[model samples]
Target: MKKFLQKYSEFMRGRYGVDDLFYFLMISTLILGLFPNFLLKNGLGLIRWLLFGFGIFRYLSKNFTARSKENAWFMKVFRPVKKEIKFLYTRIRNIKTYRYRRCPKCHQQLRLPVRKGKHTVVCPSCRHEFEVNIRF
Candidate 1:
């Protein structure tokens, strides 16, 4: 077991091995695999296999620089979507206690306590004061 582990580590020494893009490909492949055949035709199966193959290729590739660039590009493309999903989750979790609002001047998101009626709110980012009517 110890010899096998050492050999595996040596084999993977210069490989690109496991990254966000690899995980994304693997997870997408799994999700596609879970889809019913009736819902999605045979084309998705081909795509799933391709994704899985690509993910494995990435994991074992010796071209570290190329793999890093690909992962960087993937992250750049995915960052905004990830941020929005996190923001949505946070908003849902704090739905009862906080109300999320965007500051008009700076367009910054503000988390305000759940207070009913009209009130004056100040933007911490731009130091802009605005009146808000929270009728909940």
Candidate 2:
């Protein structure tokens, strides 16, 4: 029994660690405890308060201790790097290539080639065909 308990603890530590699993369990218990009965009766407005409390607890747990400080540092570094990479990708490539023209019949946005002069554009939404005055 003790051997099995030790092995389970080791596995949990390897998989998610003590803090993460504790937070997950706490949130899960709160959700499961309130979801079936209280959620239907009170709706999302009341559940949002519970969610806010969970958020506050999670924020405190991830900012108030040494281990949490390491997690916070990792999150801070990771998010900015990811965002900068995304920004660089967007800046390097032209997203204006996917610019659309509004249909004359239904006024729905239609994807057309980015070129100068008039062109026959078709709107898939309204199945309307019209000539677009494109100036590039």
Candidate 3:
């Protein structure tokens, strides 16, 4: 057992290893694999195999610069979406205590306390001002 574990660790050295995109692909593959349609199931099964193979290929890849650049590009695309999802989750969780609005100019999310009147809200990001009517 120890020898196999050591061998595995040695094989993994200098590899790209796992990252967020990997987990997303894996979870998506799992969910799609459970579809009721036979064709969908088969397609997802093929996709699952491909995703796994891709993951292993990445893990064993020696081109560190290319792998890192690919991961960086994926993150550059994925971060804003991930942030918005997290912001929405927190906003929904605190729905009673706060109000969420978007900046008209830049569409940045603005959070404010629950109040019973109209107020001018300034976006910290772009310094855009907008009127918001806060009412339950």
C-alpha RMSD values across all candidates: 2.3, 15.1, 3.4
In model 2, the worst 10-residue window by lDDT is 13-22
The local distance difference test score of each candidate is: 0.91, 0.61, 0.81
Give me the candidate number with maximum lDDT: 1
Q: Measured by TM-score, how close is model 1 to the native structure?
A: 0.82
In order of appearance, the predictions have TM-scores of 0.82, 0.29, 0.71
Off by over 4 Å in 3: 34-45, 105-108, 116-131
Q: Could you say which candidate leads in TM-score?
A: 1
Per residue, candidate 3 scores C-alpha lDDT tens digits across 21-106 of 66766676677666638646455456667876776777678888887887888899999999989988998999999998889999
Candidate 2 vs candidate 3: the lDDT winner is: 3
Q: Which residue pairs of candidate 2 clash?
A: none
Ranking by TM-score: 1, 3, 2
